[model samples]
Target: MNAADSSALVVFSGGQDSTTCLAWALSHYERVETIGFWYGQRHAVEMECREPIRQGVARLSPLWASRLGPDRVIPLDVLGEVSVSALTADLLVASSRTDGLPATFVPGRNLVFLTFAAIAAFQRGLKRVVTGVCETDFSGYPDCRDDTIKALQTALNLGLNSRLVLETPLMWIDKAETWTLAEALGGDGLVELIVHETHTCYNGDRRTWQEWGFGCGQCDACRLRSAGWQRYSQARSWRVWD
Candidate 1:
């Protein structure tokens, strides 16, 4: 498939980074589709917001929305059964294991997500897979590392005998830069959508909405997102949401 005119499947999770990556894919790819995982994580509300977020983006960016395709939500309940983390549950003791991994880290989550996305893309003749995992701002998840992604890409290609480009738009960027990217992708409305619509809190408390979306404002995800938005909000002169 030609790189200039190829379709992409975004490994979306309805979080800040994934949502931004979705917008990035829509603007860059010839045709864009999304696949979200429902692995029985504690914050399942993230999945629930996917359609509204997609539709909101479509309303704001019609041209890119025209290239958008159906978004699929896959069930991976078995993955939840095997993994014991804060994301799945409060099984572990320390927030970070002795090995320095956070309690929220789900074993093989990204690998499974990308592998499944690759298989789906290969079957559909798509050559690109966009993901929102960022090593820079990501909180100690080994699977979110570039090396892991690169190795998985190689293995997927060798296993399937097809070159699948794994695109990480936020790989090297920090959270502040991510907010900037969201704004650049579709201006203030896109930024507003990310701030108020997407769910990133590990605790899944939707009691209030802040610059970092709806959350408890105390979870790891919220802290990182809030800190990033603070930095981004100060650095640029964009219109803030009401």
Candidate 2:
């Protein structure tokens, strides 16, 4: 790879998608670092799962493990004060906003995350930011769109007067495709590590373990993941994971 495709800093959340992206970066980049955000989300499983996930991946894929450097978690307590989404709210309603935005949509969450990640990457002399923002299998968050990421990338580069590559490995792919990518990257063991360890539930429920992970299995995030897992399993001629 050339200088343009060298090292990377992944905006990791210890969730399934982000974990896959981190692995993707590790496979492709010369070096990879991860940054997490503690923005006062109601479901803090993603934040809490980071260390164990790192350890689990290390055990599963040692080649990528050493590439995983110290992951930083930036605390942004003020973000909770300004947003009324299900992620930040004390009481979350299973509905949409008055203007039709998803109830789980935390306003400017990705933007803030990428901005901070960019700053950290800049400081570390890293010019690439890998994120797991998927437009195909998501909860309709506007910030997850490709154009939004491009715009932010441009603005960040112009503001800092530095060229930074914002990489989104899962941008156009759906859940099943994501699973396929994970299997491609590190086979079934890596996929199992992600399914059992990473948390993707909005309700923070991990009691019922499924093929896709532990969640209520009814929430938007759970449904998407479960559906994808089902599709991927069927494609492999394996019985559905119960």
> Which predicted model would earn the best TM-score?
2
User: What's the residue-level lDDT of 216 in candidate 2?
Assistant: 84
Show how many residue pairs clash in every candidate, following the order shown.
Answer: 0, 0
Over 34-63, each residue of candidate 1 has an lDDT whose tens digit, in order, gives 999888998888888899898988888778
TM-scores, one per candidate: 0.94, 0.94
Stretches of candidate 2 off by over 4 Å are 2-5, 238-242
Candidate 1 CA-lDDT value: 0.87
User: In candidate 2, how many clashes are counted?
Assistant: 0
Clashing pairs in 1: none
Candidate 2: pairs in clash: none
> Candidate 2 residues 122-196, lDDT tens each?
998887999999888889999999999999999999999999999999999999999999999988888988988
Q: Residue 174 in candidate 2 has what lDDT?
A: 95
What's the true lDDT of residue 239 in model 2? 43
lDDT of all the models against the reference?
Answer: 0.87, 0.87
Candidate 1 TM-score, true structure as reference: 0.94
